[model samples]
Target: MYNLGGSVYWNRKTFKKWFATRPINLKWMLLVILVFPMFAATWEMKKSSGFSPLQLLGLLVFAFAFMSIISKKTKAPNLFFLFYVFLFLLITNLLLVFFYEGSFSQFGDTIRTILPFLLFFYFRKHLNSVIDIEGFLITFLIASVFPISTLYYEILFNPIREVYNTASRGGGLRLSGFYADLFGYMSHLICGFICYCYFYIKYSKRKSKHFIFSNVGFLFVLLICLIGIYNLRHQASWAVSLILLSMFVYFIRKQVSAFQLFVFFIIALGVGGYFYTQIFETLFAKDIAVYEGGAKETAALNGRVYLWKKYYAFWENFNVLGQWIGAGFAQHEKSSVMMSGGMHNDYVRFFFSTGIIGILCYVSFLIYLIKKTLKTRIVEFKFLLLASVIVILMYSISALPLLASGALMYFVVAIASQINKNIV
Candidate 1:
């Protein structure tokens, strides 16, 4: 019920009909909002530790887009319940940081992740009715070129051209380009791999293009992205990229027979097994410490297990209250547990930083996305969701993608565009 002009209104339908008109076509502003994420590396490169133009743009875009969703232009506003839930959790966690470890820098870092979702409601509000999101989708792929180009250029100056490293990535010295961190580098590489793979699958089904030019172009792009990840020697990214490609094979349904697809998967698994055993296993067979897992040694997994063990010990030592919320995200300033080069795992990061409940909330949000996405009928959306799951799961296992919300952001756009389509 709403109180309008001191008069009580009861019927919801009547209120909406009498309230306001739906807004007209808002051209695809998503292309603009995407720029916020595309510049993440450049933003990091600034290292100003102050307000950045990119951040200012993110705030303005999110606030304006949010206001639009809450206002007259929006369709059934309830369609965005998930986004609201996520936003609430993130904002609340931002406050939690202050209570336990009030570090403005940590606050800034948290907000950077949150800002990616600011325009999510816009996708939820307007995109459901509009079909053929290809134009919009291409922008995301194009945005990847920035990271790919910058990272590749960085490789030129590093004097390391080898594809695989043996020491800390084959000891070949994997560089992060403008991203400046292996985790961040892996995040973008995964994103680019998925983007290129999506196009490869999409264009593969396009019957008109010749096999040579069309397939070769897509293959070149996808292969280049894969090479970047391999060069970085990020094991999880390498693993996820293979899984993502396997899914791509399954999704490219029109052109290939079931038998052919099965052969593809077999080849993929065989290659992956061989690579893991030969390259990854041999390089890191021995470590400072060994753990029990089907596939892990301290060094083979790049000491992620060690870091997670450290975080786990810290969490075990926490008080009951601390266990629930962890000790907050500013561990560098507040915690007695100390380590160098930062924690590689995000789940562990969430646990040690936010606590048990915090990690659940973070995971639950992704589960919600997967659930919602499962109901989407669009094939393209399915690909996006699948690729997202692959990268996010891989990242959570082996790296901190605190700033890698681009996939989730695009996933929102893909899912939101399907809402009206699902309404019958």
Candidate 2:
């Protein structure tokens, strides 16, 4: 039943013997409950009209689990922090919707989306085998490539050019992948590409049969992502790209040289200069007002700035518990004008919703995990950790849809975790 990348040695008799000997771990059981449901729900909704990222992630988890079970492996590691946050957000947000706004489903979509990561975290501690690590990483990368590729094509060709044509004041053309929206999709892809690169480089010397093909495919995927970000005309994309690229270079200084870095910087400057020139001309030119007043055209930029202001103002509302409970998960809104969603500021979000305690716990968890991971000698481990740092750094500037695509985020963490834990 399980003969894909690797084989598991388990027959009916072997399973019975293993069952008799296997110890029941409470952590493993708790994880199965929280994480497996995402997959179950995904399969139930597979044929439905609108399947969200959460659903897709759930299905992927199920597929991975099916393969794992057939191979007779124990559960994967449990990284419950994400799940804990999501659960906290869900309950708090639902209470907000039910009590304040009556928007019951407002937080439902996000809750469902996070299901996969919740499961991933639940099993984080149990991922004990190389097969588990590889399977999880491969599935994560495989799942995200398709939807992101579709977005790349749509934006690159600008087939209908709705985003550019919409003339929206705030956001450019929304590049929703298989999921319902584009920002999150793009963020997920950027993160996944970083992780993929890390793993690809780490595995380059392994001399496996798939290394050549995987490496080439990774480059192609990366190029497509780059093109997609450029076409989308989203500053968030650029911000994330810079962060991811910088972290990649930082961690793998041995692989990248001073000359290469200078060349890359020069190229970035050239491209940025070209774009800035065009924008400057459009804004300042006397006769031709392509953006009319330039104010409307740059509304998105203004809106973000405005939101940041609101975010600061809203912070005053949360004292201590506001930080602990997280101003009630998901988002903390001040006035209708200054609405907060997606926790644009991670530190703010952490402080407001989960409180200082939660933030400290999370930070402590990361520091400890990072310290543990740093001890591993695996080159892949270092690269993966660097990529994770890249993704986290990007989140500071833009909400990179960490929750939208569970596999993408989870894989990045898992790959890094496995490497850190010496599982990979």
Best by TM-score: 1
For each candidate, give its TM-score against the true structure: 0.70, 0.60
Candidate 1 lands at a TM-score of 0.70
Mind giving the per-residue lDDT tens digits that candidate 2 earns over 145-228? 555656666765644325442333233455643343454356446755764665555544344435323534644665666667
Clashes of each: 8, 24
Each prediction's Cα lDDT score? 0.54, 0.49
Q: Pick the candidate with the highest lDDT.
A: 1
Residue-wise lDDT of candidate 1 within 135-218, one digit each (tens)? 344455555666667667766555323343554335666766544455445545666556555545544544554443254464
For model 2 the local lDDT of residue 167 reads 37
The per-prediction CA RMSD against the true structure, in angstroms, equals: 10.1, 8.8
